[model samples]
Target: MWVLTQKINEREDKNFSRKCLLCRLQFKGCRADYLSHLSRLHNMQLGQPENLVFIDDLLNCIETRLESLHCLFCNKLFKNQTVLKEHMRKKQHKKINPKDTEFDKFYIINYLEMGKNWRQVKNEPDDDDDDDELSNAENSDRRVSVGNWSDWEEDEDKVENPVVCLFCERSSSFDEIQSHMNNAHGFDFTRISVDMDFYHQVKLVNYVRRQVYMGHCPYCDKILPNRRELLEHMSMESHFIVPQMQLWDQPEYFFPTYENDSFLCHLNDHQDDMAELHLSKKMEEDCHIGSC
Candidate 1:
């Protein structure tokens, strides 16, 4: 590990010797990686001397009591600047904050940690199982019986502007509703699964005022009552694998077709093998016979 670290450090240093902006060295390093290292390791050492003076000036900016500046990740307020500075170097804050607009490559990690103390509050086995049961019951109530999940209500209300999925109508909170829409109903997930990333973020400023509803975890089949909790769970574990519709190629949403003998469900194992072989041969022929 030490050897690998040293090699990485040497490579990084050589790269830094290039045109790395943070290092200000004319070596072959990239600006992005250099900036990331600087931001993580030497935030206070950045901007200008004037900026450090500005942060120092912020110490006096408070109107009344001298409460220490808050660390953005943990939201822990320190009594002194030294402690706050030290806290920045700890593993708790080592993870990137996607919330920071300036750092483009930064992301929210430790999704389990992102559960926001909810895991601690409800770590008991019975409580977790109860949560899962409640979620299943709710899903059963809201599950659309239509052929296509997206098409169920889209035809009537398909407008130019994006709206929340019909399933997300029960979400009383704005953030939860948005997450639901993005996860379930936003994309044409019939052909392919949507990327589970949120480009926009809304603060949980009014979380206490808003009643968070429970949602089913796409993996492990657990239930989480909070939207953030669900997102964290998704990040920690595989909620949805990339759609495997291509592996068992039939139609887009083709399940084992039971209606007809020609369809997949009615086919025996030997028939399935023959069908696959035919498909492979056809694919090979297509590859050979390229468009003229």
Candidate 2:
């Protein structure tokens, strides 16, 4: 769980004074403990700690945002320090925005994979799963499976993350992100989600992520320099919404930022119904799994 806070070849110690901007706590802490604190308290996580680098810069940028009265998750502004603290505390927005490109450098997967970014890695089918596809054995049990539920059920409760906003840093329980997005952001999810299957929903989200990261308005195509300005333009024009279905449904957004992004799991309302069918289906069929 050791996070690389400094460049790889740096001579200075990596485990220097690390700060938790969300919690307003400072500690001369080891990188591992700090990462654990972030995961446990904030539902904020990057890739495996070993695959990360220059984590300190990533954190410092977040800290600077907080000090300047910006909402860490959504980059929304507040009137003053007290209101900003209350907004985050009440909304539980302690996590990082997975869509934000500011974090892409810290993750090694983006660099390791030639054509794909780290976020896309999870969406692509794993090579190991392509086993014995053409095994035309005499006994071909179409109902055959490779693994069981027990493997995933181990510590299932601990694995479930606090509900995080798909579009913001807010982390809450009892599905508060839904209400926040619908009410505060005017996201007509129920209205449009009917047209989207689970995978379509994921792509749509990633499409929004891409739009925000690229400073393009998903609704209008107007470009801004940063997320804050883009949001301001969108909010000013009431553009917090989906564009035409064809525009968002692209192959690129198929890969999500977090493999087990709990927010993504919540996208499919019919998860229970889908689970039973998935278990009984053939092992060679398309494999799509997400956990938090």
Give the winner by lDDT: 2
- Model 1 pairs whose backbones collide: 17-27, 18-26, 18-27, 18-28, 19-27
**TM-score, cand. 1 vs. native:** 0.18
- Which residues of candidate 2, in runs, are more than 4 Å off? 1-160, 269-292
Q: CA shift at 3, candidate 1, in angstroms?
A: 39
RMSD, candidate 1, Å: 27.0
Q: How well does each candidate superpose onto the true structure, as a TM-score?
A: 0.18, 0.38
Judge candidate 1 at residue 111 and give its lDDT.
23
Candidate 2 colliding pairs: 73-169
Q: Per-residue alpha-carbon lDDT of model 1 for 1-292, expressed as tens digits? A: 3434433444334343333221222434533444433343233223321112222122233211223456544556764433543464332342234444333211122122544433343454564555655576577766644436678556644322132322333432223444664566442322231221111000110111121233654334467876767656756674433323232222322221112211111111233334545766787689889853
